[model samples]
Target: MQTSPPDPDDLALFRDFVAGTRPLEQDKIAPVVKRSKQKRPAATSNSSTAEKLFFFSDEFEVFAETQGTLSYVQNGDDPHLAGRLRRGELEPQVVLDLHGMTAQQAKTELAGLLNYCEQQQLNCACVVHGKGLGILARKVPNWLIQHPNVRAFHTAPRSWGKHGALLLLLKINQSTEQQFRELTRR
Candidate 1:
């Protein structure tokens, strides 16, 4: 196919329309700067200090009646939180069973669960530490009291687990606080 040239009149009109425009002065693009990778500070020493501050001492004695319900509320938190937990008003989003684990294992699991709950922004969790011999039953409460994320806890309702389990209310992240507020409002 042979091409035809642009109409002379159309070309003249196009030049008139762009008569005042000037070519750009600097056409070369600026080079991108390569940033050096920053070295992250080591976490070993910092984590050890944090662990010491968040310590769960085996010698920490938790006083509770032999056959009574287990309950706790963090200082300055609403006392009614325990009542709500006991009544099953707040449902647990995660459940942990420490049936056959040793005390150290249970503590480790509990710490990991709390960390996971915070990471996932979950507000509630249940810990089923069987009533057998009451070893974990006693140690669990002591360990829970040391965790900063535990807002409140109460013995589970009969249908959930009764005296053998605990309904834990974890502190909600700021991003999810509104959802919990709306839930409580209803």
Candidate 2:
């Protein structure tokens, strides 16, 4: 069915009604272009070298308690470091939690953490091994002992996981020591 055209008077009235309105200055908007994230280079070589450098031996006799509190101080260093760590005098700059990771994965992560701490000139770090099956608890101290950067370590205080974690005192360079001293003075 064909419909009749609009009345001329009605069309004229509509045009007059819209005659006062102006057109939009810009109708279309520019499209946004999303940038792709850049991928970081793999540290395979660094990790491999760290694995070789931070080797832990199962046969080595670590005298620390296995399922209980642990403590160790490197030879020729101040013995008070361990006491300070246990007393929570030194704050940990980084904390690593190894709750669900396997032994190998924990080892790799521990190595990477220590390396990172050393590179950043961090003096203290906390490693939480958890009290699961006593596997990592028994091995973490031994692994820490093998790393030369570990100056001293003690079981974390009651506030910091108690027996399930250890506070490590890393061997910082002279410049780091001066910086720490300056910071502590304030």
lDDT of each: 0.86, 0.87
lDDT of 1 by residue, 4-55 (tens): 9999999999999999999889979999998779977765465754564465
Write model 2 residue lDDT over 1-186, tens digit each, in one string.
999999999999999999989877986889999876987777689768656545677666575567666889999998888998988988898999999999888888888888899899999999999999888898889989988889999999988899889999998899888888797567
Off by over 4 Å in 2: 1-35, 46-53, 182-186
lDDT of 1 at 17: 98
* Alpha carbon lDDT at 171, candidate 1: 89
State the lDDT at 182 in candidate 1: 87
Q: Model 1: how far is 97 from its true place, Å?
A: 0.2
